[model samples]
Target: MTAEIGPPKSANPEIVRRYARLLREHGDAFNVTDNQTAIVRMSSFASALICLQEGAEPIMQMTCRDRNRIALQSDLLGASALGVRNVLCLSGDHQTFGNQREAKNVYDIDSTQELQMFKMMRDERRILGDDELEEGPKMFLGAVENPFADPFEFRVARLAKKVSAGADFVQTQAVFDMERFERWMSAARDRGLDRKVHIIAGVVPLKSLGAANYMKKKVPGMIVPDHIIERMRKATDAKSEGIRICVEQIEHLMTIKGVHGVHIMAVNWEEKVPEIVEKANLHPRPPP
Candidate 1:
């Protein structure tokens, strides 16, 4: 399984290194967030470099929200120079939701276009302007998909678009509604999208009932089932209950045909990752 970790709000390499070392014990890769929620933080590139320094494989996330094509390309080239090999492309959260509302958004290209650009840079050794590169970034491309989103039937088609644009792997939005996630997976398999790319299911280990409620009500593309909330509500130890639920989700995801792996997004509860990984029988990951 993989684990997604966010950088500190300000500059703090030690914190990033600590998380990287802790998570690397059980996860195959560490996915560093790129100004997630559109809120400013340490750059994903720097955090990913910290992961690398901590002896972990870093899946650096890139968003099209803050930078134009030229700037994005420059960052990718920098990543190449730094030896970071994995990247997750995203359209990112809107600027209005972030602290910098006055900041002009630069979505010169959407996520799919970003993927195409990165893929071209890697495969064809070229940039957006078709300029030849002495050595293009050799990256394993990834994209995000929210199966819980509305117009559910079109989610798989959306994933297909990313695959066609050259996403090597796909990490889904956190899975709380198993029924819907399974249905989406089934559809992806039906269209043979699963065959084209590795699908890593996302799971969040809730810390309390309040977190569950918040996710259910506030998160735009998330769907937290009432049953899960009720379970959390009745649990005497909410944190442990959340871990149990996350482990169960990981186990269940393994049974799904198209799921290649699980992405544990423990958020602030990063220390519990090893416990959850062991409980889910994903510990001592196979050697690369």
Candidate 2:
């Protein structure tokens, strides 16, 4: 499983270490988000290094929203020198949603282009402008997709494009609508996209009725079915019910084709991850 962890707002090494240790105990690799939601936080690179020091593998997420191509390339070189192996390229959330509304966004290149650059850097030992490097970043590249997004027929096609662009693996947005996810997976399998890349499905445990509602109505590119919301509403202990539902989802996800693994995103309720993993019988994670 890939555990998603956000760095704290300030430089708090101890907090990072605590969460990294927790996730490493129950997860194969923990993902350090890059300024998630376009809000500022500790840099993903520093938090990832803390994870590495704590003996945990990190999937460092890099977004195109904040950095230019020159900075992106420089960061990649630094990450490689520092032994950060896994990288997930993303077109991040808009600055409007973030606290720093005045920030000027940069989309120097989209996520697909970034993936191509990473592939070239690794396979060809060349950066942009055809400049040769003494050594390229030996990275296991990743990308993200939203199967729940509209224009549903195109989701799998988009995934195929990312694979063609050199994504070694792809993690999808949270799956609240399983039927849609199943259909998407079926299409992916038909296109043999699953064989080309590892597909890690996303699953989030709803912490409250309000949280469910926000995702259902507020979050763009999110599709939370009415049934899920109703489940959250009718539950007595929403948190416990949420965890149970998440465990069930993970179990059900295992039976689906083309689902390589699950990314359990317990946002702020991260301490509950071990319980979820144990209840789902995914504990005793294999070694790195």
Candidate 3:
């Protein structure tokens, strides 16, 4: 039997409406910013909620760095109430990477724990307060994976654990080494995760030699090969070249069997999403 590939067909009417409006107004694609360390801040969450209310499928990325359980629950509930259904739970970047160097780190719960909490709330119909209603928010829970992590043997197991804990989908760390990623996918399949979860590969276009070098040295678990570095070096105008590279990367990623979609991390270049999507020929596959 052929393995099922592509996003699930379920869609909430509110989510659909939001998606349509975003496309009509801003073009046909969008993603949340990853540069911010604390994604659950009221301002950031409010802005994201507005995007969802406008009919965009805002993938609200929640991090464990800034919020305790109270704050996390408040934001999650708010997101659900606002028609934001998809979530990407993460452990977040260390404080040293952000502008706020003195900010406190809250690993009160890691990504896995957070995933489990969401699942419990959804399944049991309860949160911290008994007065809260039993019917929980609908969410397409997602998690992140780094294929380049050491002790490669643990990667598949870790992915399996996340799925078991209730991750409906996964977005991998930026993939410059497609071969290694492909192998990891194959192993994940052999371990039986391929049938259970959707995988969206992360692709970030190199903006310049400085950017590429910075990611290699500063960013954890991100690797851009020398050839891609060379390509960036040869481009006369780095930004345009980066966009072109992103377009090409998405095109190539979409062709991989068992691949569901591509998550574009354009950083702050949100305007470039639609162009890359159009160039790559990725449309919402009709619900199967």
Candidate 4:
């Protein structure tokens, strides 16, 4: 029989501990952010606390855009110490999308390098040069993919590289165009990547007309159909309609074969996750 894999752990330490306890008690998957802005703003920590409180396993995302090598290593160390066993490393969103325009951008290490660093820490129990008495964090490293990005070939190549770099799993960008996403997944599988990594589809719920428009105009590669937009416009309450649309979209994606799981980008709409899970019938897999 195939071994059953639980949901990825959250990167936030506090959430890690909470989810660790949850998995120990009741098993449920809780998701969290990897964006620097969210981390700095303490939303990452806050969500981690929620995961712990609810006894839910969390999948934490870590990005390279906010911290230098030293800071990044420090955070990783802290997370491991706090029992954070899963990490989704990312290069992070560009500075322009964030609040601090004047702040310096730190790309000291990209996601692939970060994954390699995590692998080294797990295998060596210490950084490459520093041989110290440290218990390395055992992290399930994950990466992100933007199937809609230009030069589709390049995106696939980068994904293969990330898997080679040490990524155990991958979560894709918000998937609006299912056909395009399926094509990318097919190509990835043909490249021998599908067998190596567990791919979780990313789903973000549209909150308002403005939100839809911003994603379409500002967030490159996120394409929402005109029909979805029209539905949002016709709804009596935009927020309610947005949630309904999210549920519908998630349900549709869940039916597609080859998708391991759905990573919902609630974006502060945490309360709605349980609803989506129920609507999609996503239950915790039995432990092996």
Query: What tens digits encode model 3's per-residue C-alpha lDDT throughout 1-288?
Result: 000011112323443344335353333224443335433223435545556556555667777887777777778888888777777788888877766787778788888888888877766767755445556878888888898876788988999999998899888888887788888888987877867998888888677888988877778787778877888888899988887887787777767766777777655444465566666665443332
True lDDT of residue 232, candidate 3: 82
Give per-residue CA lDDT, model 2, range 117-223, as digits (tens). Answer: 99999999998899999988989999999998879999999999999999998999999999999999999999999899999999999999999999999999999
TM-score of each: 0.98, 0.99, 0.83, 0.81
lDDT of 1 by residue, 160-201 (tens): 999999999999999999999999999999999989999999
The reply for model 1, stretches above 4 Å from the true place, is: none
Ranking, lDDT, top scorer first: 1, 2, 3, 4
lDDT of each: 0.93, 0.93, 0.68, 0.68
What TM-score does structure 1 among the candidates reach? Answer: 0.98
Of candidates 3 and 2, the better by TM-score: 2
Task: Provide backbone clash counts, one per model.
Answer: 0, 0, 3, 7
Displacement of the residue 96 alpha carbon in candidate 1, Å = 2.0
Q: What is the lDDT of residue 224 in candidate 3?
A: 77
Find the 10 residues in a row with the least total lDDT in model 1: 279-288
User: Candidate 3, TM-score vs. the true structure?
Assistant: 0.83
Candidate 4 Cα outliers beyond 4 Å, as residue runs = 1-27, 34-40, 43-50, 130-134, 284-288
CA RMSD of each candidate after superposition: 0.8, 0.8, 6.8, 5.5
lDDT of 1: 0.93
Q: Write the per-residue lDDT of candidate 4 for residues 33-111, one digit (tens) a residue.
A: 6544422454443454455455555556667887777777777777766666677788887776666777788999898
Question: In model 2, which runs have C-alpha deviations exceeding 4 angstroms?
Answer: none
Candidates ranked by TM-score, best first? 2, 1, 3, 4
